[model samples]
Target: MSPHSPARRRTAIGALAGTALVIPFLAAAPAQAAPCHLSGSTGSCNGTVHQPGSPGEGGGSGGNSGGGSGPVAPPAPVGLNPNQGQGFVQVPGNQAPPPPAKPATADLVAQAQAAAAFPVPIVHTAPKGKTFVRLRTSLWVDGFHVVKTQPITVGAQTVQLTGEPATVTWDLGEATRTCDNAGSEDGKACSYTYQRSSAGQPGGAYQITATIRWNVTWSCEGADCDEAGGDLGQQPMQSEATPLVVGEIQTTTGQ
Candidate 1:
């Protein structure tokens, strides 16, 4: 038989046909997923987890959802869906809600005042803690940063009430006196003359209280400062009780 004969040509044709048939069996297989290595509370997906049944994905495809904008169960391979409360993947620290908004200016003053911790009034007296009946007892206060300047946050601005003494109303047991300023120990400004002695009272003393009225005005700053900043309204702060001994005078009348 010759090399160019029909028998030789037929054998070559069969070999080419066999090679073509095996090519379909050698076609590529579907890709295997990358393995995930979770180290701690936080982990990363080896490849992005494409959660099925999400918005664009058709309903009930891979997940149990009827679908619409709802959270679907994610793959458990990458530690997903562990902390999910609402059916979505819960990444730590990424889900914190925003903080509360600042209150309106009108509501801010009273709210700030209630929250502010202005110092309480400090009480002081003249006559070195003792006095004589029918004598000028000279009752007064030590003030000591009384009429406290309090800085409060109203909206975005800082408002401060005046620290200067306003009115100190002294309850002197027998009489009440209000001073335009912190009372003076000298007989001039805020002196109170006791008509009766405190000898009959408990511990031979009169328990005195000073109520300080603070100047309430708010000065505003910052770009958001408003006309609402002025005159937040006055508030009264009372002082702790102080003790004063009043002794009766002994006078000898000529017989």
Candidate 2:
């Protein structure tokens, strides 16, 4: 007892060192967590496993054993129009095209008549507005002779110069030259030097237009000048109108 001193203390220290060394070997190992496994298509976890007294404990509680639950959400509603959808639904927007343009009025019949009566035999056809015929003659006449065969224009009716005599003015293109008579029979004709205002048409064709206006006493032989024809009318005096055409290119000199 004098000194359980130095040696005893040394021995105690050695023993402590030895115990520290052996402690790790004697302790239980940590429990390992299993990797998650994807199971049946349903994808719901079934169960889990755990170590009873292992050094590493409580880890098994949160371990993934292929039986762990997977993320889940509610299913969408059934039976809706396919076009109608969640995020964004494309739409063809409603729209109207521009209104169709209006067509132009065609005066085909009138144009045909104009062309046909281009340079001869003035025909007074009833027109909607102010229809007229211009006659270009070699002789210039101040007066005009108007006779209604079947009442060509203004319908089939008799019109007379009664009461106050109507003063009919004659208009010959630019100037009206006085003449003895004007018509097919003895009507004054255009001046001898009369030539087409414009040039003749191509391909030996001549297009000349002349106009004359006059005031004549209205009367009919059997029927009044008013009552006349509809589609066609016979020549009252000589020809209601006169149009002369030369050859395609030749002049009176050649013909």
Candidate 3:
């Protein structure tokens, strides 16, 4: 019959079959691989798998254990409500306000009229000196002249106060000549002669008032100073004074 006994052959086959069955069961028994999980972009057996937990399925506990991201803020708004606390705005240099207007012609004319309506009153003025006196009063007179001389007496005189006093004496500077009007019924031509020292600077005003000791021989006619008349009385002769101003000195209107 069979070269080897039947029992031995049967035993060998039984051992091979048992080994195959055991190996398959061990391979199928849920491997000890890492727990199923999502690791970054890759899946891993040992890592946890994220999922929306089924209703009441441990209520999501231990399900998706991922950390949530922080809230993202919106950009700032623009337009009317925009932030203006940043920079300054520039303006053109020539954009200044206009200047005020000048006075009108009518206004100027009115001002001139007002000024002309009321003028300043004229005043008396004179210069002071020794051996000589000047008439500075604004009194009305008949004839006047500026007189000067080398040997003028400064002291008091017979006809008036002497010295450089404010008022002039009757017998001022030396008498040059005396003449009388003759043969006239009206007796109007009598005049006394006196001399001035200097013409002074032109434009200046001057006057001479002197009381003389004249003995007219006789009363005469129009402007005739005849020495042949009767003895005449010595009287005071005042001159019509001329106004003098700064311009009179140099004929220029000084400031």
Candidate 4:
């Protein structure tokens, strides 16, 4: 039993050999899942465990459990094309949206008539149905708004129409004249001088009339600009006729 004895050495060697065999068995044991606390019959294990029906690695439904880069994304749903884009379907640059439908001219004309602010002819001199033969009878009308068109929307496109006074026409029951500007109340424009009396006319007065003509245009914005656009031509509005009488002044020569 002495520390240096042959029997003691042999015993020490046998103990060392036993320790080596036990160390290999410990190393070969399966690793344990951390936080594996068991409470009664039900407990939780953090380590991977195969359920009775669950596929392990390549054995399960979606991907092979044997693994390379991780589970392949399930095949894109049937009939859907898979895209590499970030959640968006890429559109071709050459595809262009269709233009809006053209608006009906008749419909626009009706709308313009409803929205138009018409001007009545002002008989500056012939208001009382009488005027001097040698003096000019003044008549004019204001150039008011014809207003904006109702918005026309087709698909993703929209259009709005607008109008402006373009011409004015004057009728004196015998002659007609057109002007580039609206009639002026200053008597410099839209005045007519009677060369003769209105004795032969109906109601003993000549009928006078004034009309305003507007030109309409339309515009669009954004991607639909210039679509469903057109001109509405000349939309004319006339004022009621006024009866005017031209009389001659009789003066006797003094003796």
Candidate 5:
């Protein structure tokens, strides 16, 4: 066994090549991993194995390598007032908006008046009858009853009105009188007896005027009654005057 024999030399060269191949793999072998230690939401290792794409650390291809993502923009505020440069004012959750104000009593009455189409009462007594007797007088409304209802609107609110004839005033071209009751088919509820004949009066007749007074009441539609309810006051309507003749009893003496 020579120290440098051909077989020994060839064996030594093969061993060296094998050692060179194994040396590279041994150098790349991984070391024992350090026990991971946690600090808050992140972890740390004793070695330099850093998390990929972490802030202020470089590891991967594309990302913010050194700085944290720009401060997350805050959400825009809602219901901001343009006049005042302040944040939106928060209303109380339990509170609600107040309802629209009710219309005034006078306004309601005016609305009713505008909607009402009350016709003049017709004088039902004879215009050319003799006087000095208890002459019956009366009035009649063609299509109206004791109580009438009508709907009216004022602004944005709707209401109902009730109207009725309160009284019928008579002006006999001499004095005035009022009738507060309804009349029958035969005669009027009120009658005036002439003191004398119309012979002395102007034009040989008396002018008789009949006026009607209306009472109105109102209430909000689908709601409670308002101040316009219960005697909303009265309006007077009159008819043209009529003529009536009167005659005196004649006396004859024979000689």
Candidate 6:
């Protein structure tokens, strides 16, 4: 019949099927795998993986990892004892503060002055004679004792201040003299013999004044130290003025 017949087509199809089966058998196959190894906090295939300990890992009681819920906070620090600490002792909130600092020296001095720490100057001897004669004199405190150790409280501090005469300064109306450590005794060492009559001076007499210097010191219950303004050293304490009459001695020998 025709060149292309049914028999011829069936023969061609049979040959194609046989060729496809042989080609699949000729293709290459996959290679074999190497062994997998693991170490502490690390793993490796052909490459490796590593994890290290974080800083302050063992400082406190807490987990190192931050994976669970959230991070674990470290323990609280321990407090120190105030009485046993090495450096500066810590003051407790409940502890009472030290007694207020001692009052200033100037304050103590003012208190003493207010209390009349030094007694009024007393003239032991009065001058009664003509010019050229040595004026016999003495000066002293009437009470001649401490200021009774008066206690003066300022702010929160209390200081006891005691005072007494340390020196005496004399104003002879015409001249002045300062005697140290001279209290309650004959003042002959500091005496002055007037050379002229009182007619030249007011009231026809010399007006004499004695000033006593008070030496003050202060202290607290626990310390013997002086207050800041205490120890005013030598403070001038004055006395009322006294009049002395000096007349010229008459010499009616050879008229």
Q: RMSD in Å for candidate 6, one decimal?
A: 13.8
Order of all candidates by TM-score, from best down to worst?
Answer: 1, 5, 4, 6, 2, 3
lDDT of 4 by residue, 1-255 (tens): 699999999999999999999998788565452223334323344545443224432344432333223345766678553664557665667567786675544454445446655455343443346877777766666654565766755544555667777777888775777766655655676677777888888888888777877787766544534445677576777877777777776789999
- 1 or 4, greater by TM-score: 1
Q: Candidate 5 lDDT, tens digit per residue, 1-255?
A: 786999999999999999999998777555333234334434455444445455434444342333323234667678654445466555547576798776775576676768676666655554334554444443332323455557666555566766677788878765677777544344455666565677778899877777777787766653533543555777677877777776665769999
Give all candidates' CA lDDT scores.
0.66, 0.33, 0.32, 0.63, 0.61, 0.57
Candidates in order, TM-scores: namely: 0.53, 0.21, 0.18, 0.49, 0.49, 0.46
List model 2 lDDT by residue over 1-255, tens digit each.
335788888888999999988887566233224343435332212354333322223254342233444444667668654658575455556456686642211222222223332112242211211212243333322224443222222223332221111122223323334333333322233232223432243532222223432233223323223232123222122223223333223337654
Candidate 3 Cα misplacement greater than 4 A, ranges: 1-4, 27-33, 37-51, 55-59, 65-255
Model 1 TM-score on a 0 to 1 scale = 0.53
lDDT (Cα) of model 3? 0.32
Instruction: Give per-residue CA lDDT, model 1, range 164-214, as digits (tens).
Output: 457888898878888887766676877887889998889989998988776
Q: Candidate 3 at 5: error in angstroms?
A: 2.2
- Please give the lDDT score at residue 21 for candidate 1: 82
Number of backbone-clashing residue pairs for each candidate, in the order shown: 0, 38, 42, 4, 0, 4
RMSD of 5: 10.1
Angstrom error of the Cα, residue 181, model 3: value is: 64
**How many Å off is the CA of 232 in candidate 2?**
20
Error of 6 at 176 (Å): 1.4
Error of 1 at 204 (Å): 2.3
> Which candidate number would show the highest TM-score if scored against the true structure?
1
Candidate 1, number of clashes? 0
**Alpha carbon lDDT at 128, candidate 3:** 20
